[model samples]
Target: MRMLKRFFLIPIVVLVVSCGGPELPEEVALEYEALPKTLDFNQHVKPILSDKCYLCHGPDAGNIKGGLQLHSAEAAYSELSENPGNLAIVPGKLEKSEMFHRIITTDPNLIMPSPDSHLSLTNKEKAMLVKWIEDGAEYKDHWAFIKPEKHKVPKIKNEDLVANPIDNFVLAQLEPLDLKLSEKADKETLLRRASIDLTGLQPTLEQIEEFVNDESPNAFEKQVDRMLASEKYGEQRTLDWMDLARYADTHGYSVDRYRDTSPWRDWVIKSFNENMPYDQFIL
Candidate 1:
């Protein structure tokens, strides 16, 4: 799959933090990667920490090494009570920050992710870490805990092709790249697609003819409603739920024994048919 990357450009002067502490070896100093846009904590810095540093120093207290925690600013920015004046991180002070020193250290005893652990960081990751600290190392609550904010829908060049708000969002990204949505599917094809999607069955010849002949503005929606009302819709939807919930029909202790578990499967189908709320269904 191809990845689409978008950058938000903001004009601001970049400040290089003064290197005030111990000098690193020439080989240890990484080439600085310039920032054209403000670094977002959740999007940029959190991912790097989660992937490379989180396993030992993250949420798992028993596994934590060096009494160091980096999951949030409150936990990490404080001076340790045991060590009177030492601190792990000081936002916007790259040289004073011990974490950065440990990252770029050459001493086998001091370097992290611990050379013996076989975990390593790419030059890009190292450069990003440096840039983040220089930019104040601001932290935000995890996305799951934050309330969502709404923004105005983007205006696109090709508005006629848009049928809904989602289409506008898609076209906003594509218009810049000279890309467009594929040609609209014909009525017969659309009916078949909708039937298969809703009921996991292809449209019958009669259903296709009726859909193509209806010629009403809401003909497609009406056909979708009919498919959704069919018993097969519940059956089709239940297949995924069955797989996820590990619905089984046998007890095997080195011997495969068969037992009736159809009632549980029926329950899932019934829940779908009744349109049970997701939380209620899960519970």
Candidate 2:
């Protein structure tokens, strides 16, 4: 598939705790073809922790299972009383890092995500954690919770080709790589792209004809407006929301019986078409 627009690099932030099956050996082999120069704490480590460790060791103070807390850097790295050593993680020294030792330990009793929890880590995840600690175990705020900031739009040589500040930002990245943006698609192509993206269907012949013949500079913008207001827009967005909600084919339990969720699904489509605010949509 051809990319319609150049995508600029954007830094993402997520708050997650590391959770994996077992500790890795002090001399663990890296799974990557090349080791990353820098490991992102929020991206690589947080999700693993969030999935496996957060229930017992996260922000909820009352539910903290062990005295150890891995959600925050201050807590995760602090010395724990149960372990022989004081520090849970010792930056830049994997062998001395107690957290690293526990996961890599072959002793069944000593492995984390304890056998009872039925959680396990892949070799790749273990390597990432190891690399992260070796890189100094830095922690930062989760990306989502951070306040949104306006970034300075980058300057690019292809100023005439850019449609917006976003395009300028994308072009700036491409300039350094010695790459250039593809030519804009014709009006008929644009119509089809917009239709499929927003409504999951192609533009009709008449719609294509009208768009191609229109000479107005804002013709494409009008088409975008049309798709956003279309009934199919609601349907398309509802399908995306379904994944986020973890909608499944059957009841996710022992019985695994089929169930009806059409009403709930329909409500989602209705809310989307109504253009509900993000906070209200979650509520």
Candidate 3:
């Protein structure tokens, strides 16, 4: 009856664990159904741990359960105190990794995010953890904590099409796919594009006719100037900064209520319309 009862336990936990959750094989023999891409510890694994496991096993010293802190590489990779010879994570060895077994186990008392903790790993998450540990369980510093650095602009073969620094990045992407910029847009199409880009409105019929009739080499430049001169330009441009500027017309937090913030909003639009110097606008 004991042997039959053991066989009825959750599908994966029984096979993953030992006779009484003590003995473990030395070989790295666990299999993954599929690993879609090369897993990165910081990007893929850290997010899962943060959302599900971190509540109990995270960096918070006061709430740490099981006396485990999995917020870093050094601690998780160390030997477990409770189980002298065992480790929570054994790089490239899932068979010997206790964390792997805890996450996979279905036993009410043994599984992590415990039965009453009301947290569980999805099948895909479980697989990702398995793949991560089997691949050596590498960890890295969170991206936010790292200092930022400027990268050299990537060069592309088609220098003729490159109009700005941004185009260099665009063409660099296209070069890999054996692609190039679409043929130069006709004057009418170009004017419409510039009108929409600068003022968020299509070129008026009068504007289209003016652009088509003017054969001057600087006709497109003049149209751009005209669009930038429009008040609509400020309205269109300020939209992108609305969220960045945190432009809300209310007292946010505990008690939300209407507030008169239109003056600042108008100032942003007015600055754009006045063609304020970049530094002055930022200041």
Please, what is the TM-score per model? 0.58, 0.61, 0.50
In lDDT terms, how accurate is model 1? Answer: 0.74
Task: Give the residue spans of candidate 1 off by over 4 A.
Answer: 1-54, 57-62, 65-151, 245-247, 251-262
Q: Quick one: best TM-score, which candidate?
A: 2
Against the correct fold, how does model 2 do in TM-score?
A: 0.61
Q: lDDT tens digits, residues 151-258, model 1?
A: 689999887998888899899878877998999999998888888888899999999999989989889889988988998999999988878877775662446577
Cα RMSD to the true fold for all candidates: 9.6, 12.2, 9.2
- Per-prediction backbone clash count: 0, 16, 0
> Model 2: runs farther than 4 Å from truth?
1-69, 89-145, 244-259
Q: Is candidate 2 or candidate 3 better by TM-score?
A: 2
Q: Is candidate 1 or candidate 3 better by lDDT?
A: 3
By TM-score, is 1 or 2 better? 2
Q: Write the per-residue lDDT of candidate 2 for residues 1-283, one digit (tens) a residue.
A: 0110101111111111235323334345646324556777778889888887777678898877546788888988876534334576778776556667656555555556667788876767777777888778888796755677898888889889888799998897688779999989877887888899899999999999988888999998998999999889999999898888887646856667788777888888889888986667777
Please estimate how well model 2 matches the true structure, expressed as its whole-model Cα lDDT: 0.72
Clashing pairs in 3: none
| lDDT by residue for model 3 (7-120), tens | 223245356456533333222222244444588777788999999988978889788765567899887887655445556788987667767777766676667768687988
Q: Assess each prediction's global lDDT (C-alpha) against the native.
A: 0.74, 0.72, 0.75
Q: Answer with 1 or 3, whichever has the higher TM-score.
A: 1
